[model samples]
Target: MYKRILLPTDGSELSHACVTAGLEFAQQLQAEVVAVYVAGNYQYPLYVDILPPNGPTEEEYQAAMQTLAESYLQPVREAAAAAGLACQQVIQFNDSTAKEIVHTAQEYACDLIFMGSHGRSGLGQFILGSVTTKVLSLCLIPVLVHRIKHH
Candidate 1:
């Protein structure tokens, strides 16, 4: 009975699988979908003298990241359109992926969060950290994680 579903995608194959699953669920429930992409803010060292001369400025890097994020969100928009479901795309610029996802869901009043897990285990997860895991722990709304099996 979800009226609004929030789908966070990183443009990975696994995430696309989650998008398809989320769309199917939304279609079944006759709900709308909000797809979000979180772009991490580019951080540079405070010592400008150590930077490369050809490196992009902070504004340029941010713009490039936003463009890439829009490209990543395009497929979700098209899929939702083909399914004839109401869809909205949001591009959030923040360093914390999990926080942005949860914040967007709450800001939009989404009833459910449908996301994909990277399937990292043991030391990998511990060392790299998982955004899905963080979202699960922090989000107030129900989260449906789609785990893709890699053969």
Candidate 2:
């Protein structure tokens, strides 16, 4: 039984399925749901050369990121509200998605994390690996991965 469930969404269809599954688990356990969106930080060394000297100072860039965060997590928030579960949203800019997710779960004291398997494979898997796999390897809390079949 979980008291708090952490759900991460990336605005993808599979992420939506993960949110739905998380909601069902939260409903069954009478648990609160926390939705986290981890934004990619552009400060990495490889990207340093590509960024302007000041970096992302444009209002449009900031606004776009903000809008993205809100829109992406909005459905999850609504689902939790409809289910009568206490819900909160978090946005973090980080270089490592898996690290951020694991950290957020710990910070929120979540008993469980429900996520989607993005199902990357072949060259893509070799190049990018999987965030779910990395999180599963690093996390301490219980992880329930909803495998969303890729079309």
Candidate 3:
């Protein structure tokens, strides 16, 4: 029923597995795929009084993030090509990964978001932060979280 699907990845093996499954699902639905990598924005060091002489400049940070994004999204691109599925790739920077994911979905008019969840619960989720939980709470579109049991 969905026309477009958004897949967000952090380059982990689990996320890549999710990407493969999500692409398969998109192929079944005859939908286009949007692969997005949201990197955290560069933050200046907190010590204003004692500034470090050697820190990444904003431009340097952007370049590094871009390189990292390409690394993370390369598999997605290759998978989409192999599946002969139409794919759009996006790179975004934001403090909140979940918000960026939802925004990307809305911006691309994606009908569904298919992403991996680490299955953190209760205290673990609260301490480590759960993007899946945040996305489920904030997103208006459908979210299908793929979880793989880890040994």
Local distance difference test, each candidate: 0.86, 0.83, 0.88
Per-residue lDDT over 96-128 for candidate 1, one digit per residue giving the tens place of the 0 to 100 score = 999999999999999999987664455643332
Candidate 3 whole-model C-alpha lDDT, 0 to 1: 0.88
Better of 1 and 2 by TM-score: 1
Candidate 2, superposed: residue stretches over 4 Å from native: 43-55, 58-60, 120-129, 149-151
Model 3: how far is 129 from its true place, Å?
A: 7.0
**What 10-residue stretch in candidate 3 is worst by lDDT?**
120-129
* Candidate 3: regions farther than 4 A off: 48-50, 119-129
Sorted by lDDT (best first), the order is: 3, 1, 2
Q: Across residues 10-55, which tens digit of lDDT does each residue of candidate 2 receive?
A: 8876578878988988999999999999987644445555766755
TM agreement with the true structure for every prediction: 0.88, 0.82, 0.89
Cα miss at 100, model 3 (Å)? Answer: 0.6
lDDT of 2 at 92: 79
RMSD of 1: 2.7
Residue lDDT tens for model 3, 24-142: 99989889999999999989889766667798888999999999999999889888989988999999999999999999999999999998766444554324238888999999999
How accurate locally is residue 49 in candidate 1, as Cα lDDT from 0 to 100? 72
